[model samples]
Target chain A: MIESVHEVLTRSALVSVAATLVAAVIGIGLGTALALARIPGKQLMTAVVNTGMAVPTVVIGLAVALLLWRSGPLGHLDLMYTVHGMVLAQVLIATPLITGITLAAMRLLPSALPDQLRALGANRAQLVLRMWIEARIPLLAAAMAGFGKAISEVGAVTIVGGNIHGHTQVMTTAIVERVGRGDFNSALLYGAVLLALAFAVNGLLASVRHRGASWERN
Target chain B: MGAELSLRQVRQVRAGREVLRIDALDIGPGEHMSVLGPNGAGKTTLLRLLVGVDRPTSGTVTLDGVSTARRGVEVRRRVAYATQQPGLLSTSVRRNVELPLRWRKVPRRERARLVAEALDRLRVAHLADRPAQTLSGGEQQRVNLARALAIDPEVLLLDEPAAGLDAQTRSAFFADLEQALADRATTVVQVSHRAEEALRFADRVVVLVEGSVHQVGAPEALHHRPADASVAALVGYDNLVSATVRTDGEVLVGGAPTGLLHRGPAGAATVAVFAGGVLLADAHGPGLPVRVARVIPGPGHHVLALEGAVSLLAHLPMRVQAPLTGDVVRVVFDPVLSVVLPDSPADPTPGVLDGVELAYPSRVPS
Candidate 1:
């Protein structure tokens, strides 16, 4: 029982971290582009991103499962009921949330900041990089928000990963399996572990935020 | 090491409306020039053009004969702009002053030296390690100026550096600013709405009105010999009484002799009277009679608002007994404190008793 709990916790951590990293890379880049570039259809694209953030995790899971099911469009890859499919589903769920937060963060900066940077001899690339550095506190918060959302979700991982013992079980699906077998003690144990995992991640993120904010001290 | 900035036929149009139009203007190397204008006169737009942040709608703002808009980063590296707002980064004062030097790829050792020198110049060196966002308003402004001066650019653009400070702080801010630029051979252009602030240390002053250059001359020229009635009001002249120039060069106000003479064309003209020049006279004296409406006391003088043939304001010395409200007294104009200018079509002398148009050109062709 102890070994099974440890395996589930490690797999959950790996899947969520991998998904968050991929989503953050795509989302932060796209969000910054949307915020600064003068492109057509910007309003429409922002609306689509905002709507994506509100989508249900179960709905994304169903879509990903369908894409990976036998004889489906992407069936040949045979990724159904696997860790890869679970990570893909979580990525879809977290990307929009990160993107929306990043876009809002960039817009909240002082409007004259870009011009001030340019006048100080910063070129295009330097301007964006400096703006990102200036807004690090909020951008760090966006990443944390994305990671939290990706880890706590269960309905999508269950539908896609199948909770197969020893292979594709994460903490969320393991808690469901333990409860179904009338194993209340094991279910409660998994629940406590999941809560500790969230607290640990949040603690780490808070430390990073505090370090970034230290420069603001009087 | 300073760069000469010249604007020839520069016109900036925003939202399909012309905001700034300068036919031709030049600032010599190492010279300090001030652009004085009221709000919405496009002073900021002109500054942005000169800084190469935004290209003018037409014509060119050239630095040392090179187009600011067309030339790329190399040209911009030689110029620095300090905006009205502090706009400090959320970092230490030392970093805020050091980043520009770093962007210019200055060596780390040299960057530290320049940053220290700039902070010392603005007298904010003690706040170097403090977070820039935590400083007081005055401190923030000093840091902003220090950041701009740290780059050691050839041309510096200051857009109302002391804009939102109180009277005392504004004075002190300008003093520090002047000290910072004292020995640097950098061409500087500052814009402001206050006459005292704008003319304090400028080698030449540009009076911009309604997006046009009304006059560009020495600070004394703007004070004593304004181009027109509007320019007079901008430069601290409080009374713009309409008058006429006789064929013999005598001045008449309200169809009575003013005992002042002007060499302008003998027709409609305005007597731009500095309040210091409006003197009190006896009821039987040779001047226009007016009833004192109000008297406001100041440190060393009293300001009297008088009503009669023309609404007028006068600043009288404290030694002279001030006229009480409702007292009807005659007033005379001191020729040394007033001058006759070509009547302004834009701000027509409101109560002019005469109207015969004459073509009298201004000192600076408008």
Candidate 2:
């Protein structure tokens, strides 16, 4: 039972971390572009992103499930009921949240900072990079938020990964499966492990944020 | 080498309202030009265009004949701008000063030298290790200027660098700033609304009003011979009173001779009177009779607010007896301290005062 719990915890950590990393890359990039560029339909895009942030995990799971089903358009990839499919579903659920936070973080910086950076001879890339570093605390919070949403969500992984033991089951799906089988003790153990895993990851990230914040002050 | 900046037919429109329009302006290499204007006069808009942070709605702002809007980072690398706000990054003052050098790809050793030199020049070297965000406004501004100067930019643009500081701090900031740039031949352009700030340390001053360049000349030229009544008010001619210039060239205020003359075909004119030139005497002389309304003490003088057919202000030396409020006195305008500008119908008489009752008898000078 402990071995099974370890396997499920490891899978959960791997899949969630993978999804968070992918979501962060896409979210930060998109958010920065939206924040700085003078593109049209920006208001509409922001509205869509805001709606996506508040949309339910179950709704996103349903969408990903429909797209990756055997008869669906992406069926040729054969990702349905796989760990990759689970990661994809979690990414969908977390990307919008990370993106929204990032957009707000970038906007909170001094409006003239980008121009000041340009005036200081920073090229386009340097401007964005420096601004990100300036707002790194909020950005790190965005990443943590994304990871929290990714690892803790149960509906998306349940629907898309299908909880196949020794194959696609994560801690969330494992707890759900144990409870279904009336194995109350095993369910409580998986739940305890999930809570510990979240606390450990967030604690590590918070320390890194603290160091980044105090790097120059000291 | 310093870069020559020019604006040709430049116009800036924001929210469909024209904010700045300049037909032609040129700052020569190594020249220290100051753009002087009142608040909302688009001085900052002009600086933003020159710094390439903003593009003009029409025409061009060019550095060495290269349009700033189209110029690449190579061109931008030669210019630096110190904004009105001390926009410091959340870092050490040393890093804030060093980042520009880093951006310009200065060698590590050279970057260190420039950073230290700039910090020392701005008198902020002692604050190097301090977090920039924790400094006071004046110190942060010094750091901001230090960062801009660290790159040894050929063209430095300062937008009211000492704007919000107190009088003493502003004076010290400018003194340090002047000492810092005394040896460098950078083409610098500073913008400020205060007359003293615009005139100080500037080889040439541009008088901007309502998005238009009213006058551009040497600081002394703008101070002594402002082109219009509005320009006069901007350049520290505190009292703008309605006057008439006779065909014989004698200037008259309130149907009385003012002992000043102008070489213009003038029927009506506005007399720009310096506050120090409005001499006061007991109401027995051949001058305009006025009632003292307020006698405000100053550092070494007394400012008397006087009411007559027109409101006027007179600066008297502290040794002289200043009249109390409601004391009638005769005020005379010294010709050397006054200029007769052609009638600017749009400007109200006495540019700085309001609410004082002015009831002149219908007495026309013959």
RMSD of each: 5.1, 4.8
What is the lDDT for A38 in model 2?
Answer: 90
Residue-wise lDDT of candidate 1 within B1-366, one digit each (tens)? 789999999999989899999999999999999999999888888889898989998998999999989885777889989999989998899999998898899999999999999999999999999989889999999999999999998999999989889999988888888888888999999999988888999999998888999889999888867777778888888888888878887778887666566665678888888787677754674667789999999878999999988899988888777878999987766666777875634322212212221111111112
- lDDT of candidate 2 over A5-111, digit per residue (tens): 89999999999999999999999988998999999999999999999999999889989999999999998899999999999999998899999999999999999
Predicted candidate 1: what Cα RMSD to the true structure? Answer: 5.1
Candidate 1: residue A168 Cα off by (Å): 2.6
Structural similarity to truth (TM-score) of each candidate: 0.91, 0.95
Per-residue lDDT tens digits of candidate 2, residues B1-366?
A: 689999999999999999999999999999999999999999999998998888999999999999899986777888999999888889899999988888887899999999999999999899999999899999999999999999888999999999779999999999999998999999999999998998999999998999999989999888677888889999999899998777776777898655566676668888899887787633554567888999999889899998988999888878777778988877766656777777744322222211112121111122
Q: Note the Cα lDDT for every prediction shown.
A: 0.86, 0.87
Q: What is the TM-score of chain B alone in each candidate?
A: 0.92, 0.91
Best by TM-score: 2
Position A11, candidate 1: lDDT: 98
Off by over 4 Å in 2: A216-218, B344-366
lDDT of 1 by residue, A43-134 (tens): 99899899999999999999999999997898898899999999999999999999999899999999899889888889889999998888
